[model samples]
Target: MSDRRILPSQLERMVYETIRDEIVSGALRPGEQLVEGRLAAELGVSKTPVREALIRLQRDGLVEIAPYRGARVIVPVDDDIAEITELRVCLETFIARDIAARRPTDVLEALETSIAGSCKALADRAEEQFVDRLSDFSDILAEACGNKRMKKILGDLRSVLHFIGNSSRRIQGRAARSIAQHEAILEAIKAGDPDAAAEATAVHIRSIAEDCRKAQVPNGDGRLPGPAANAPRAKARTRARANR
Candidate 1:
């Protein structure tokens, strides 16, 4: 990638967001080294801003910084996926229940709009847009529940969840299934059925977790399987050897 300089005042936050988006979009694959100098050059910023961004990414659990080894994308293992899945199930189910009981018209309308956008994206085979809309759908429901703290927690988890979802949804039929699940949850909420909404949310999360598990790729050594094997880094390696 070419250098893209950030303005002085926006350096830190912009650098962090840029790198985070790259990681989430799989442009920076898992386990790929994030060299300070290289990222600085590519981002057209000084090493200082890049260093600060790496620290923030590390804090977000998206990167791991070693003392002398620099930073690398943290590969999401099965355990990591499972833990995130459980947390989402707990928080989102509660949010669904609350939203269902409250029955906020504005929130419902926002969710419907998101679902409609998602359907259009899927029909067009626009994977990125589809996932973005799905995330928006979840965020609207969570915000509607009116728990600021819970909403903040969910926001904190959004990047990693999106990364996982992007990987899992690549599987055949997974994206369609997810849309159906979201529809079910929305239907329950529209009907003012808290219990049904909660159940639907739980089921959706569990299904996503299962799909993520199936999408995991075995590690290079055929041990310690992780999601990294499915990443671009692995494909690059395969191509490198094939051309030899």
Candidate 2:
């Protein structure tokens, strides 16, 4: 059997995907500095690929690079969140309508499976799994929507929204509500009611936007609160300790 080893370019892409997932999953937190050396050490690669990976992430609008200051995760501003929400409302509503109109058996089954998984995750208090499965449900709809361009656009928008969603789900009662909303959308789709599916999708997107807004930092800086604000300072302290 041939060795199934990753190539250098593939390794760089792997690093990029790993970091991007962490950011979207909220494990990295917004505004956190991405130290190349640390990531390189953790991933068992040279700093070169890590640096390249950061550059790739920067191009994807997930990281910000500064001259001589290294890279940091890009925190979604209020306008960024607002614009993404609006776009998602428009695009995802259309996607839901398309899926409902088509009612492909395979796609509908996938969505149903995702919804069931999401419910179980929520019931079990598996927050991370619930979020992932919920996104999977939407992704299924998007993919089956029969519009490649819209799918690509929604995918990009959802990456940013995923971060906000990770924060929004932390609010009391939010996860249960989201699960119910997803079920509504799925039911509408199963009924092959385009209008109902679109309406359900719109409601769900609006609720998510509202929850994210409520969770926004109150410091007038339009940034995510809590860990996002503290991450930079925490990184600085870690660096100081390392130097000492």
Evaluated at residue 141, the lDDT of candidate 1 is: 82
> Where is the poorest 10-residue window by lDDT in model 2?
228-237
Score candidate 1 by TM-score against the native. 0.83
Q: Note the residue pairs that clash in candidate 1.
A: none
Residue 18, model 2, lDDT: 71
Question: What lDDT tens digits, residue by residue, belong to model 2 across residues 177-231?
Answer: 8888988998998899999999999999889878777766555675455531112
lDDT value, candidate 1, whole model: 0.79
State the TM-score for model 2: 0.82
Question: lDDT tens string, model 1, 1-244?
Answer: 9765545546677677778877776667667899999877666667897899899999888999998898998777889988999999999999999999988999889989998999999899776677689889898887776788998999899888877776676457887898899999999999999999999999998888787676666457753233321244434334322322
lDDT of each: 0.79, 0.76
Give me the runs in candidate 2 sitting further than 4 Å from their true place.
1-5, 218-244
- Could you tell me which 10 consecutive residues in candidate 1 have the lowest summed lDDT? 223-232
Best candidate according to lDDT: 1
